[model samples]
Target: MDQRAAIPVTLPRDNPTQSYWQLEPDEIADLRSTSSLPDKADTVIIGSGITGAAVAFNLLSNGARDVVMLEARQACSGATGRNGGHTKAASYRSFLGHQKDHGTAMAAKIARMELANIRAVHAFARDHGIKCDSTPCDTVDVVYEAAQWELDQKAVKAMQDAMPDDDAAKYTLHSREDVWEKFFCGRGGDESVCGGVSYEAGSLSAYQFGVGVLKLCLAKGLNLHTNTPALNLEKLEGGGWKVETPRGVITAGKVVLATNGYTASVWKRFQGVIVPLRGHVTAQRPGLDMPKEGLPGTYSFIYEGGYDYMIPRPKGSKFEGDIVIGGALAKAPADGLEEYGTTDDTAFNEVIMKSLDECLRKYFGDNWGADNSEGRIRKSWTGIMGFSPDGFPFVGEMPGEKDLWVSTSFQGHGMVLCWMCARALVTMMGDGDEKELDAWFPEIFKINEQRLRLTFRGRLS
Candidate 1:
């Protein structure tokens, strides 16, 4: 059987594993602006995750009120809440492959755009005083395998040569001699296993971030309806869309599909192009006596056949600052494509669970969990991510669909780029041209016919 075969896409799964971020449900989790759905709205945003809330906020900020945001479940309950909570951007890790895939100029633009979004998020969190556990820190891309490390070095050099002034390229690549200190800092382990590169990055609780933005939007007259699934969308006779939900039908001048992995449920054309891949995540608290200050910054461990990302929880908690970790798709069955088009986050694979169980011990050594009292698994869950064939998000007016814009298929990097993408998209939604919003978006992210014609082989790397 072809593992890459497409599956019937739908809304988010009913019962998903709860993430640590949702440990304390937000006031807006299941909020509805009104007891019943409104009949009309100037703009309707489907999917109240990070992307949708961003669009709604920006649109309202730009004086476009009467915005309605609809969600299938609780607000930000999908990938946004289920994510690892890391907000770091791609420094030079994917620059080489992206350069090869989309050309040097476009790749540089993508890298720069990602970094800019990181800054934008930090600024938003600071300016709004959003207590989303926003942590502005550096990220270390620790490479353990010899081959990948060498490739990373070459990629960084190439990126520097191409865009010398690129801030993303302004990272310190540590060698074996200093890699251990740079990575562990006398915490994870003392052994000099491999090397890594460190650069500016940030982390935060995405659920809180989204809720904060949604709260502001609601204050500005944004109507949000939770547990309201957008069952169908029909083009109105004159100039709008009639969105059908279980609650009621609502007409809107414009609709933005920020649905991400569940996009195909509302937009059928994204069937093969936007695949929903299920990923597993784990949150573990340190033992009663484990050192809390050891793991300071966010980390991405790149090994020979697998990779895992981890972000530490904030200090002073009953759980004693658990570590949220995910990724290692390489260890998944059938080259990981077996999960290519799955919209199911209700079940998690045992194989991936076992891999995640042993990741910290393998990378950080025995210090992570020497005994039962030291390392305790707290919560484990699964989330779905939208994967685009071209490995870039579709962030513009849906091709051939008037007034229907989409900001989906972020390929699991939504936290790092969705804010800026939404900001630029709202501008595009206005009378502004691509040139005016060029600084906030990459050219390849734009939805066009040529991209729509390409064969999608479930390539998410």
Candidate 2:
């Protein structure tokens, strides 16, 4: 689809997350020595993370010219770069909802679309040569520790029955056998209940992915700036927009806001739709001795009381040594772990550590390797993600604004191609159908007049 002509917008800012992504020595050298600020453009993108990068990459490739990207900090400094790096086929939660609201077929379609997006992401990566160390594996969605096998069974059955025909051969329904046989476990499992759902997904060094996108855009003459934050936005006469910052002003016909968690306060209407929520994540330098069978499919980091996730990087490929176990401990009642995050690495102090520690005690009990094996806590930090009451992202134009659009708030799993989210938004902005795109996402984002009444009826915040 071709977009109408519009001036570009660019803001200059330095990259802020070179260390977090563990940039290769060479990439780091280039980034350190080659940073620049945003310049003038026809269209100004407000973020430099995954979604912004994707939109810019696609927009530029789609023939939009003179586009510039602006970031408050360095690229990938947001959730894009901070995620657990697992790209799976859609949301298990979304699938469950589909089965409930529309039935098995609709839920199947949702899963199929998600699975297809996984393949699309990989295919695009290959075609574009965007190397982010992406790894494809089947993930197992384990039930809550005390939950039953029936939970996993019932969940996977709905998924399997609703899955698209193209991916039918790519999955399997197994009892704990798949989890047990594929990845040996010393302890901490219940045999009688819900099993794991095995399906192929991908993982990558997330920061690298965003960095690569920025590099690609830079190569394409897309003027980008780091550190330059848009301080204000002025609606220009004749149907255009101009963004003001401490540095300068950028005039563009339209603005695309992809600021997920760190969404700016410059825009009044957007203030409500985008809610920034802080999430805590901890990564150890390198711990754990891998089993001979290799790492099990990485999936949702779930447990009894807290959520946890672990993945081995391609750097060692499980042959060398060192693994990182990361998950949510709890909010320090003192520090308010839920709203405001604990910057201290030891937030998992006694209180917060109980649940994960107990899970460890049950399975590895004094297990060496997981969390340093000697029960040592490594590094922990807070990253923010846009949150919503119902967990749906607002991916269309500002409800009543003209020529202004947004793609914000992904709660946790943005693995789904929220391309659908953006696609719907863009389509609606350009007078195209957004139903299919809207269907794949959470129900609350639909733009109809009664959408609110239907979605959150008595649940307004």
Candidate 3:
């Protein structure tokens, strides 16, 4: 496929590979608030993942009635349901690059916002008593290359130097010896392991959290329609929009596209800008000789061109001690370029599965003894993520598009950016205090003609 070409994205495929995190569907998974689609609504949100859930929750909590949400598949079954179950923000890894592209202040602002977003997600889950198995824990980025390890040290230092002491203290650099002793006790002095950095992070069932929020919104008079994809959008001359769907059409005063990877399918302007990339993940049972209590915390095995992230299922849960691992793009064909611009998730690449299987044995060595009776690998699946050329989400209203708003292109870091981005977009839609938003939200995330033009030029060049 010519990625630069303006090819319209396809809708979510039916019978997608079953995700480990979604093995047990939520009660609201196939929910339809009413028997029939409403003729009109005050607000219509496209997509029913975390972004849409956050937007609807904020709108309803603020007394906005007549809100309707549309989902293309089972509710919360998109990227939010198929991700590796992490709420981590490895901001230091991108500190220098962000500082060079944006200014020091803007870079610092983005880092802080990411941290704040993680805290907000946990707080909401806790405050609402959402039983998503949310857990606060430390995360380690284990570096494999010496050169990359050196760069990581400098980036961490730069990030710390730019932030306040309290926030800076959240990150700590660890030597190879330290990583082996503290986290990977079974590695047995692997010379290939360089070092690592640890920081505050978390893990939770994103599907559960999103469904909990949507349940709250439903109680607040919000309408939700699942298995109903928005096929096309028409703008009314008098104001509002006409959202065409397979079931029926719904006219709304305002429309919000939280579609992420599927955004280009409905909005032609985002065709090349918000490119779709397929990612694979798996749930594996620990070896018989491995630690029965599970690993210490969330981890990212960082290498030259790609990384694999893992999060342990909470202790005492049905799948306790099982590790949810994902990302082996480097081993895939063309370094995974074959995944770009694809929306199908019905199947996953066998190469990625083989790479993940080998990775476990390579990293764990002897500790990863023989597989148990149940087998080592439990399940594998694929999900699509939206990639922005500029590495920032497009928030706020689309340039020159009246009453139409967007909060997509999270670049696979939606867990750390979606909540706040959705909140900021809704605040702007409600004509809330602009000064307050300016003080907290990163200005770089807002949509503007300059960003649109730059991305278009890069794609067509």
Best by lDDT: 3
Model 3, total clashes: 0
Question: By the TM-score metric, which is better: model 1 or model 3?
Answer: 3
Candidate 1 vs candidate 2, TM-score winner = 1
Off by over 4 Å in 2: 1-20, 23-40, 102-106, 146-148, 164-171, 186-194, 285-289, 304-306, 315-321, 329-337, 340-378, 418-461
Residue-by-residue lDDT tens digits, candidate 3, 320-362: 8888899888888777767778888998788987898768777
Per-model root-mean-square deviation over C-alphas: 2.2, 7.2, 2.2
| Comparison by lDDT, 1 against 3, better one | 3
* Candidate 1 Cα outliers beyond 4 Å, as residue runs: 1-5, 185-192, 287-292, 316-320, 372-375
> Which candidate tops TM-score?
3
lDDT of 2 by residue, 1-461 (tens): 00100111122223322333443432422232135444446678887777787777767665678777777765556677666566765355456765676676655655655666666666666777877777777676554464644554556555555554546325565555555555433334433223455667877766666677778877776777666677778887787788887667778877888776555355654333344544445444332543544556565444444455555455544222223344544433533333421112212354444433334323332223454454443434445555444545666666566777777766555655544455445555454445665555544454333332222211111
Q: Looking at model 2, which ten-residue stretch has the lowest summed lDDT?
A: 1-10
* lDDT values for all models: 0.81, 0.55, 0.86
Q: For model 2, what is the alpha-carbon lDDT of residue 95?
A: 60
